[model samples]
Target: MKFDVVIGNPPYNKGMDLDFVDLGYKISNKYTVMITPAKWQTTADDYSGCASKNINYKQFREMYVPHMSYVCFYPQSMEVFDIYQIDGNYREY
Candidate 1:
């Protein structure tokens, strides 16, 4: 299937742990900063990160929203404590 515009209300929380051990995956970089927020509090290791408490937001952003042509969706409430604006440009739920 082909997609053009995508939108959704993403949950707000911490992050997730990624299985990069046997996946043979490579991000091509080390210092990557990613920002993940969900309603439920989850450990950063749940998605993609080096530590269970620290989530690799940069890797998450690259793996999830790596392209600029994609329309990202996100909830407004997540922006409450955030230092940046919640304007829609990339990365949704």
Candidate 2:
């Protein structure tokens, strides 16, 4: 079995590994989009920088990692974010 398009609204919370989201891209033939939790909230990474209580957008963007080629909110101050198709993938499709 194969898929031309794969879409998912994955369950997310603190300390959740997003490896499954990567699977969506691996299986899809064309496109895959994952709507993850807002960057403002603290995630598993615990990377220092984002001070959400102060409404620090710059810090949030700076701390965001393991994602590139993504569609991000401009002047992104507490906005919804999603990762787009990256140049290379974790696995061949």
Candidate 3:
């Protein structure tokens, strides 16, 4: 099946967020929207302590960024969701 839009709030663990975004973009014909941690925007080397370190962020950025129409960020202090905070050593990511 094909879709015109793909939207999701994927888990923020182990770089799964980017995986979702990638899949979304692949399947969607018009738009792919994801609610994920903002860490993927930074250099992969910055994720040395987490699974995201393995992601080639440079390639991801080059491929996806140009196609993105809009992007948003919320401050760390702001609670975007009412759910409990994720537990991990790399909370920032």
Candidate 4:
């Protein structure tokens, strides 16, 4: 089946967040809205040791970034989820 939009708050473990965005777009006809760590944007090329190891973030960026319409970032310290804390070393998104 196909969809007009795909929205999700995918798990953050093992780079599943990136997977959701990748697959979400494939199944959606219009948009894929996902809540993923903002860190991915800057550390795109650094997931060589994780589950996203096979993903070429450089090429991913080149393909999908231009189509993005909006993005919002909240500091990891802000505890947006109030479930866990992410390292605040990289604060700018």
User: Which candidate gets the maximum TM-score versus the true structure?
Assistant: 4
RMSD of each: 11.8, 13.8, 4.4, 5.0
Give per-residue lDDT, candidate 1, residue 14. Answer: 27
List the candidate 3 regions with Cα displacement exceeding 4 Å: 45-55, 77-79, 83-93
Model 2 C-alpha lDDT per residue in residues 1-93, reported as the tens digit of each score: 557876776554321324435566668777667665454344334454432343243333453343435655443322333433233122222
**TM value for model 2:** 0.41
Q: Sort by lDDT, best first: what order?
A: 4, 3, 2, 1
Error of 2 at 18 (Å): 0.7
| lDDT value for model 1 | 0.35
Q: Give lDDT per model, in order.
A: 0.35, 0.46, 0.70, 0.70
Off by over 4 Å in 2: 15-17, 38-70, 74-93
Give the TM-score (vs. native) of candidate 1: 0.26
How many residue pairs clash (N, CA or C atoms closer than 3 angstroms) in each of the candidate models, in the order given? 20, 0, 0, 0
**What are the per-residue Cα lDDT tens digits for candidate 4 across 1-93?**
889989998876656566778888889999889888765677657456446644556656777788799988776535565454645233333
Work out the TM-score per prediction: 0.26, 0.41, 0.73, 0.74
Q: In terms of lDDT, which candidate is stronger, 1 or 4?
A: 4
